[model samples]
Target chain A: MTDKDFTFTIDGASVTAQPGQTIMEAADAAGIYIPRLCDHEGLRHQGSCRVCTVKAAGRSVAACTQPAAPGLVVESETPHIQAMRKSLVEMLFHEGNHICPVCEASGNCELQAMAYRLGMVEPTKLPYLEPTRPVDASHPGIALDTNRCISCGRCIRASEDVDHKGVFGYCGRGIHRRITVNGEDLAHTDAAVSDHAISGGVCPVGCIIVKRVGFRLPIGARAFDRQIIGEAIEEKRR
Target chain B: MTAPRKARVATVSLAGCFGCHMALLDIDLRLVELLKHVEFDRSPLNDLKHFTQRCDIGIIEGGCCNEENVHVLQDFRRNCDVLIALGQCAITGGLPAMRNAIMHSDDPLRECLEEAYVLSPYVENATHVIPNDPALPLLLDKVYPCSAVVKIDHQIPGCAPSGDIIYETLVQLLAGKFEGFDPHIVHFD
Candidate 1:
């Protein structure tokens, strides 16, 4: 470990993690994987998906949000965590207007991988209430689908705070809600498409869908395949 | 009966359209069945009667619009036993909520007037950018979902809601059966 006396446990196995690190950051440092959707290395802690949630100090909280304390006990992948993540996957399934066949990201999607990871048989908890929504194929390279969004706000916050390419945002009150693509069209046609790299990078969900390149990868082969991200960054300390 | 104990509930909004409210009204016929067990108090529908009965299940729709909506939403948290975000507006901030970016523009009444309504001269004389009605509840600056405002117990999302869900929720509310998502759902995704 890079820092002095930085110690923690994952699944009852004690390990020395970097000092003042998050439980997620510590897990990443040790090459132990935990599924997550709303966390990125340089970006802020979203912890929205709740898939990364762990049992820390005898309670459940987002591993990404819970900062590590010395001798902290963390259960990275317990059956409870698995069940909670599976329920979350079911919620995503029932929520947005996600139609994989028509979606470009069908072959290479994070939600699909999560479903596979969880061995999701069906959404038995909540019934799928598919709301009718229009696709925002308004631009040349990007597509906005409000139906598929879990409202993680990683995209909106990334747009407003990080990229400054604030082309999109969430608006309206409850029930009458949506992720508006700029008060108008967000995908570039005759519009300023903002910085594509920055915009695409910030989205945790595939809400701000890029027209090409992103969705071309083979199934179960995206960057977040199995806690593929965040680990590398935390490992830098080691 | 001795004075009834209070039921703890809250209401919140996320990013979605408030069509959840229209959906909540889908239980209008079933409301007869519901009120037998629990009380329906506090809502936009309570214009004439202000805060009369304490709500057991706080039903909310729409996401947090701005700072004021956040503050007002706490009203539900204060009085209810369990909070239920009643529609898509409560869960994901439905269609109207998608306007978080400057893309959709900030004016909500204008959008409703332009898109959803067949406006006439008699309906409060609304123009392109009509002023907030002093007699009516004010509009928030932006839109949001329910969970953003306060802790939510149950969330029912759709453009509106189903009569069946309200019936089920009422039964559960009366039985004091709370915690977690509702079973007997039709289709989720």
Candidate 2:
């Protein structure tokens, strides 16, 4: 809206951004969704999941962390970029024990929704890791299933920034990387069901679940059942 | 002129619950129309236990959790020109693959068998015997998706992909369209 704002083109459409705004922020404002996993609204962006990888001025960059520059052209939905995003999503599926049929977050999970959006009917390319992760149900009102965690750091951010509990953090590295509680398990920490990190949908996927209220909604009525992810943002263009 | 030879289709439920086959039956009246174009070769719909000849399409409805499932899937891959992994089990190992997470210890299969036959609270096995019948298929260490055991040309992803999805996939595959289902039509659950 001003002369000082940076302007860029994403998939050939012009997008305007403020000086410090990232490519994701600009494209989002312009109603273009660069497929993302780790980056959530209001939370600090961690460019961990490369699902939001985009070709910016001929180089692949994480759109959520990369600052939009004047005259920069970014390609988000090209066949090659889309394939990359699909592969990333597939890797996430293969790395985790994401048995969707029995999963508590089958329909409402952003990871599952992103997989559907990426046209991943089956994750055949990568061998399933099938790692045995801990499931902490000790919390009186919450449950933590680490098998579905993508290590996006959203819960860590939300707990630290929003709830100010500093309850969640990461331990280990590479494939062994996992979310750890401040103390022993979730119950040992200051985590409560009413905490913003738990109630605010910070943990995308079924990693953090509220006890005893799962499967309340039928299959066809859950989030991302009929409406595709990012449809609401894309609707702004209309 | 004689009508074109009907497409020969075979189907099998390996480690699945046969819910997918039920969904296939859920196609309802469309099965009559589908029968006009295709003939069952080894499917349970006709109760044919063995494939007598090469099949045009083989719809597989489960992952390989045991030796029998692997053999059946490999046979399907050999006999059919096209092999489709139908439903979540076949595509991604589904509910059965939940056991794969606990396969870190030695003899994970025996651990699973013991848990089911001896340790489970619902079981009333006073003798604590795990079935070791030689006739029973030997359990694999972990459940594997159909694609891991044999080549899967296409996959339909759902707990039991709706009857409409199964019908459309069959019609499309029969018409020689291999583009696969639209993303919107595909669901994991």
Candidate 3:
């Protein structure tokens, strides 16, 4: 007798996945897009930026940071997750300077794109402000504009683990807190800082802009700009 | 007639671009809408020409470097009903804080004034020359982020935070419904 195929249901949609596949993997296979930040497929999960949070059996968890499980009822964009993410995005927005219109990252900025997708039109209600933002022009190929920084820890983490250059370490505190480069003394000197700190990459938002790479291409022609982040994320699952 | 209540605020600037302050002008259309509910005093915005009394809200930009930023912070705490850091300079010290790691003084101003301008005799004009004062405001010996200064109540963050956050903050304060966040970070040294 021929045996029936094994399958499971997620949010009422039935789909088949490997016997030990995780919920996230199953959902990815089924093409149910779950928004996330902090968990890059190319690297280890840091579980930062809770935007990818989803509800599984009335519990909230990060899809990117979590493994897929079988037969688990999931809710990707529940109100709680959405609200939490909206607040988180707002917090990140307020924590660092992430103005989309003027930022060089523009369409390439994940934070900006996500804010739009979530319809988070209102700005943060906090009245805090940082003092002066230092522009580090030390690295010939990169510039760090601290004002627009979100401090997702991607740069710091990338430096320590991936790039093997611990040039950037955090300093000070709230509103006053910042990411320091090589003790913050002599960054924009020459390629001296870059020579050592040039891990996989310095920053995610072009924060550590490559000096020689300036205006290399038209604005619309950049990596993330030409394609919608959501679309790209969904495409990856396929 | 019921008298209008003043919205308390304080303004400060540390190592900053002042770009966020400029963005406030982008809200030209809503200026009148805002003045209706709030008042501005002791703002570096009105004119750097002089200092005024503290009011309901205190807004600050720029990062703290040397001595002046320190005094300004004290003044805001003493006078303002609420002290709000306005932009990246104040929020994360934006780019200025990046300099705190090192106090290297290429002092771009010195080069532009002492070397570049004076040497360019071919193009130098009477008005184009710079003063030899080692104290010119343009010559920042060192850069700093504002967070190193006084405690900030809430941060608007963009290089200059968006006018949207600024205006929203003002409106909320005017309505007497502002719930600000602590603009301090606890460092474990």
Best by lDDT: 2
What does candidate 2 score on TM? 0.97
Clashes of each: 86, 0, 70
lDDT of each: 0.60, 0.88, 0.58
**Per-residue CA lDDT of candidate 1, range A120-147, in tens?**
5321435345555566777776777666
Higher-ranked by lDDT: 1 or 2: 2
- Candidate 2 per-residue lDDT, tens place, A1-238, comes to 8889978899899998999999999988888888899989999988999899999999999999999999998999999999889998998998888988888898899999998899887438678888878888999999999889999999999999999999999999987888899997888899999998998988889999999999999988998888888887898787
Docking class of 2: medium
Error of 3 at A34 (Å): 5.2
Model 1 agreement with the true structure over B1-189: per-residue lDDT tens digits: 876654433333333344555565677777665555554455545442335556667777666765556766777777776777675555554455544332344554465544433455446444544555666456564455566557777765334556666566657766867443333232112
| Local accuracy of candidate 2 as per-residue lDDT tens digits, B66-99 | 9999988888988999999999999988888887
For every candidate, C-alpha RMSD to the true structure in Å: 13.1, 1.4, 10.0
Span of 10 residues, lowest total lDDT, candidate 1 chain A? A189-198
User: How far off is residue A32 in model 3, in Å?
Assistant: 6.2
Q: How accurate is candidate 1 locally (lDDT)?
A: 0.60
Alpha-carbon lDDT of model 2: 0.88
DockQ metric, candidate 1: 0.02
Worst 10 residues of 3 chain B by lDDT: B180-189
